[model samples]
Target: MTNKLKAFIFPLALTLVSPVTLGETLRPEGLLSLRELPIEEGSADIQRLQITDRSGMVLVDTDKALPLIENEYSPNSYDGYTAKLLAERQTKITAIDLQGERYDLLSPSTRSGDYLLLITREEGNGAYNFNLRFRYDATAKSFDLNQVLLNENNSECDHSLLSTYSIDRKILGVISIANFDGRRVFGVLKELRLAHQTSGNMAEKLMPETVASNFDAALKAYKVGDAQALKTLVGYFLSGDEDGDCEPGNYIVEKYYFPQKVGWSNDLGFLFEQAGHYPEAVELLQHITRKHPDRVVAYLNLADAYWALGEREQARQAYGQYHEKMTAAQKQARIPPRVLERK
Candidate 1:
């Protein structure tokens, strides 16, 4: 692995999470838990972040069939409640804006231990009350939070359309998946804001917030197909590594006072690859191979990266090794006419 790849992975992996304070009043936001009844598990992307105990919440834009747009547009004219203390569960989540229209929240949890927000609204006849239940998970150290309806269902345990997480004992940071490309950019912006809040006025000194924002922005750049941000994030990753390995900067994370985890590594690698950080991508893929020797995606991707850099021999070797494990059908399914065009 190269020093750059090491740098890229270390800080991110190491900067796990700290207890985040949610609600607009607290500023950058954190965990969520709706208690009255229970919110249903709608989708996997949302459910992926949700464990048995904690999960971040996001409002799917029912109108646009998208995640909430991150534009500077004003919030909806819908009258609702913004509470820091507690939320009621007697209300119903409309087909319109379920989460945000019903509730608005921060995305990633433990983003440098920043402040988060929650905005809940009731559509049409706001007769029933809403209880947004949020439970904290000390193990993963996140939260399980969701929307709840009070008056529905039988005496059953939250079988209604309440928002519930599958996470176990981990505090969940309310989050959303905007259109992948569009959303990543918005997510990076949110990341910067959270870092700024968590920096505790150390923005200039530790230059605290710049690091993560830069990392995420690079991902966003690639998402929109922006080459520069992609490269910069790659270079930043490289520069951070004095030892050419992906570490998530756990050292710095510990030194800087933050939580740590292997979370987001593959995703981070994906951003690097999308941004054309092939060598860095290769290093990241290699990192994953150490743990999951059977993941063909990593090897296939790494080989491609090697080939892109004119390292034909290395690429061939990687491809051959991974190809051995692939079924003939799998290989045929994956190959494109362009692959045979390799020089």
Candidate 2:
């Protein structure tokens, strides 16, 4: 990418939108409601349930609804959506009391006309036992039980769920953690289908050439400070396979782009950092250090990101690594004054 392209992709501002106020009723015609019931007759355990919408339309009455589990741990794990709901506590759901029962309502910030209602019950050990999910379709104006996503984390095993949304395509890509044999692994969950593309259009394909062109376009948009266009292009590239097997854009970066350009991952990490996505930058930089340990500049970038996140010890470690790898001349000429001062 050129300096102009660099200018385009790097300095975009992030706007924070306050969440919509949610009172006793949900949005889109108050189409969802919650209820609480005892686990058994006279039992202290309670089940926060989804009975119907505010309009009294029954959604699902059965508690034994089969949930969608992560495919990797199938026969072992619950749904990937459940894992995501558990991991991203800040963005996914919020605790609210409805008619004396505590329920986890999907965060109002995520409201986009479509609604996802998650019902969960906490066990004595603090892990979730029962999980249910329901969806409200804005177009159809109907509420229905979508799927159960059950995930229970315990002392012997752990799970993580990561999800990224595509604004342009309205797709959600989920990565769920599962233990296979004795090792932990990540598996992609089923992804929403890609929006229809014009047939016979080579430009729409995920081929290397097409991806390269899109990358250029994204860089150009970034240079021009077209946040929407840049994000759309990035989302298009990051689009996951319909089969939920892989991310084509990430494949292109690892298989084609990185090999073609030395230190490309480092450059990308730096770009993410400059864009104020510190966590993303840190993740990318950490990956680069593990995959291409010889990329010395990545250590400095990683340190910068760690420092930005107020992780002083991690930042110090990264800076020390970078310092140890640099020659005296390089250190004097290229190292940032901040790194030297911190050291």
Candidate 3:
């Protein structure tokens, strides 16, 4: 295995064995225990489980059609039979939901006093697993189905979802990992905001509120030329002191900070330049150009910043690149006069 694969697999392996316990009851009042109902003779020996209220109304049932396992296996074979047996034996229940129903609930804090129940079921010869999430509603005195997460591991590749919740911020950060090519891995982290008050369905309540809020704040700060405010916003999202590979702090920047805005680094560079912070502008503009080379406009902004910093040769090179990329009409009509002069 490569280092990147090891980085992802090792921490996950430790989490599976040493789960972080939240020490809170996820079960709400009126919802009875999760009980396993006996399988009928014609039901093909598959165990059925149900979550019922005090009034015996079934809220969730594993016997019903499940999204992941509906068409996964064929009927009545030794391999299929053994798969079901393994699934039943390996089924796990936990307070937090993540990683194909693995029991670990890793988070920085859980002070929101919310409740969640997770049930993970293995399917189809132990290659696929499904995690069912249930969140409690205090007002209605019931549990709401939140999400169904999947983890698939086979000879070809490994694909899974990992998540963490920040109760104070009311943000749910999810990381999706896809390792299809042997040495190349791709991962994306998305931060979702939960409702302020847990009254509605989780699907409807989850949104990118924080992302919007941060973006608006940053824009406002830039418009007002408030360098201090912009710096503070950057610190909030980008600061991390953790030591290790694949650390959660590292992803905080990746998910909540850098990816939220279009041409974010470039915009920040402009904001810094307007505020007379020439060095910061040069650094940020250079970063964005390297990170997103296809963003043609960044070259123009970078050239101006370099000129402001008295780097004449570098500024000329950037101006030349921008001049080459612009259409004839743009070069004549839109290109800044200083760019043509400098190039």
Candidate 4:
């Protein structure tokens, strides 16, 4: 993993006329619609979406946040389509259709725009979930082939859903999620340019060693309170060329996606918290819980930040959840009781 500035290259963006050359692929006639999650069964606002294209209609999957469209039309390849997504901030179900399908939709004629992939839960029980697909495309930009993905489901009901107009978002999160042996939420890299490769099982065969090597240099610079070094490292994070498949690159990827859980903006919050930027930490962490309820950890950490800032009840709520995530044996491994006491 030589960091001597690997001469990187970005791919050309796809044109509307870019040949859809897989000969056997199905022609998309109408708009395809998907949802984030299903609304409560009996609620007045039963959520749904209606997908139709300028020509006709595409397939729809009701309950899945990401739907895999099995293509009988394509041959000799894993050719299918999914309106896949990851959890994120400021999520809204927007609408639902009679078929119990949730949709993050746009007008039938809107050509290219970025879309937010979200999920909606039934208001009452929070039971059935559906995909939330919203268009966020810009002129000329198209859908990414790799959708939001999770390395492991970590059993966290709500996971972070991240999306950037870029293709490398998930590669960086690799380290952060692995740290807690937990799952992190991220959108997939459908852009052919990124070229991410995945396996049914990928916890092993980690990223190359060089990514870590660069990360170590950056971290050392960070510890010494070097703002310039921190800026450079942070620059690597926000860049579009990260990969989780190698080492220092993996380290770069991980820290970029650090605070690694899915509930809220914990990724950003963690960085702020570490720097004693409590106000920002509280604000960002609170954004996660308020906007994304499934990120249980955000609530707990929000409490920590709140307590640190001397905010009581909010801290208590966070501590309450934190205690539940702990075990009886772990509890006895004792720190002060009130270290987590809300009040």
Candidate 5:
């Protein structure tokens, strides 16, 4: 990305999980698992799963709803439990607010300790109901469902909800959905508050200055259309070096870091495309498409970049993907001349 590198200050709120020191390397055993539980043969449609606490205790079992008495930690152990359905065919389960309005349910639950957050759709109405916070009470050994209402009540726009649930150093972060015109790119929203934590009593946690400095160098390299510098940046992050150490291969940046910037690299790809940096644009745009397969614009950009580079097959595939995902309106609106004239 050529724009000046601006450090993202995380606005975090702490959840009331068992207190562990911040930055403490939590053993893998001390982490709750929210992975997709495996499915049985011929059970392709069934989305059964399990939620376990950091101590490897089963807190919520979709197959067997409520009062998880035994910790049967097996993907196949859910045979006896009834899988809780999030939606019915095309419909979803939602809730009524004080105003008696309906909304769509959020997806891909967020879990921290004994607490699990799930968003379900309200049937008939295509909007989310509310954020369901289920806390596992050890005393009762039963799960309690608590309703966390969303503050915004703009019922006119039919707003879509997308969530990226993350837990970083004792903090749970859920970025909401942000739509951009025809793009409707889904990512972690700007709200920046920790998911499942209602309290917002935290200050901005800035990225280390060293990390910012390294990113600045990468940005400078990007501005000048230097492929070597771009590759160096990728290597630096993947090399497993400490955070902020930019030595050729000594910085620790998660591969997901760039994708999470939400439209940052996409904008940068346009810059590179305009500058005729086909190789650079192709590399960056390819990364964006892989990170967000639904972002059709990224594919369009990649198609253009590839076409410019004379990689005909790659360009054709990119163009195909872009065209396949386009809505009827997008297909009719401002058709790409290259798409129409493709050989």
Candidate 6:
């Protein structure tokens, strides 16, 4: 893609108003309320539960023993509008042929500003399993039944019910849930921009050709091992305008734009490290570590990036984390034979 075209694709902050007249804009109306509904069914244990705002500010943190019930479906009885909305969601899941063994209410209903993320687990019949996101509207004080995100899997590998999530500004990054590729969790990052697009309401638009072309260009530069060219292009993408906005001079047609996958970000970060762009590499690598803590290699790469920048203490801390997490077998498999000799 031409530099001009690339400039038009990634904007720092997306405009709420779209030039291509589409669906009516959604405006939140009320203060979102959160309640911890008692879990009344199944053996699904509470692993970890916390709620935070867009800035990573902790709103609520709870590790109290969660109340769980049996496998048989027992619908929750509630008369309030919001409660009714949640009840309907539970009933719908019960009716579906998901080959579900049991259901678990992962956490009590929690709201972060205008959005409420409710998680329900459907224990699978062997490989087929999924978690449902009953996304509620805090403004309307009702669940938007239509915008539910189902994190489902049918693979043979056993999966965990818990998934890590992070919010960067207005975007919500849910790891391993929507973006897991059997082994590595790719990630499904969504911008919580309350706007409507032609595709549908609350739909995340994939990185388009206009944006992908730049990524492709970077890859092409990397394939031939042109470090300078790759760095230049990536720098362009990373560069901010006079206002320090990342996306500058771009008309944001899509209401929501998903970030590049964790794998993609890792690739770019390692490339940045190779090019001696330590700070840039650190930024990208840090994001992967935060969003995909399971990816051990990211920590190693981050340490290398820090070391390259003469940030010895930071590098030591990162390496310490990496060493602590890697098992003997895992370390043997991941670390090169030559590198292992030093240990």
TM-score of each: 0.33, 0.32, 0.38, 0.27, 0.30, 0.36
For model 6, residues 239-288, the per-residue Cα lDDT tens digits are 34354533311211111122435676677677668767677678777777
Best by TM-score: 3
Please give the distance, in angstroms, between residue 72's alpha carbon in candidate 4 and its true position after superposition.
38
The local lDDT score (0 to 100) that residue 34 gets in candidate 3 is 50
Off by over 4 Å in 6: 1-205, 243-260, 336-343
lDDT for 96 (candidate 5)? 33
Off by over 4 Å in 3: 1-49, 63-208, 242-294, 302-316, 327-333, 337-343
* lDDT (tens digit, per residue) of candidate 2 on 6-87: 1112221211122354542323434443333323222221122234555677653432221222234333333321111111
RMSD of each: 23.2, 19.5, 15.2, 20.9, 20.3, 21.8
lDDT of 5 at 324: 70
Cα lDDT listed for each candidate: 0.37, 0.42, 0.42, 0.36, 0.42, 0.40
Residue 76 error for model 3, in Å?
A: 30
Residues 173-278 of candidate 1: C-alpha lDDT, one tens digit per residue:
3332122222333344344434444552322111123345665677677678767757666665443334344333322221122112233455556566666767
Model 4 whole-model lDDT (C-alpha atoms)? 0.36
Regions more than 4 Å wrong, model 5: 1-167, 171-257, 327-330
Candidate 4 residue 311 C-alpha distance from true site, Å: 2.1
User: Model 5 misses residue 229 by how many Å?
Assistant: 18
Write candidate 5's Cα lDDT for 194-281 as tens digits: 3333632232111222334555676677778786776575443222123432221111111122434536557556545655656666
**The CA-based lDDT of model 3 is what?**
0.42
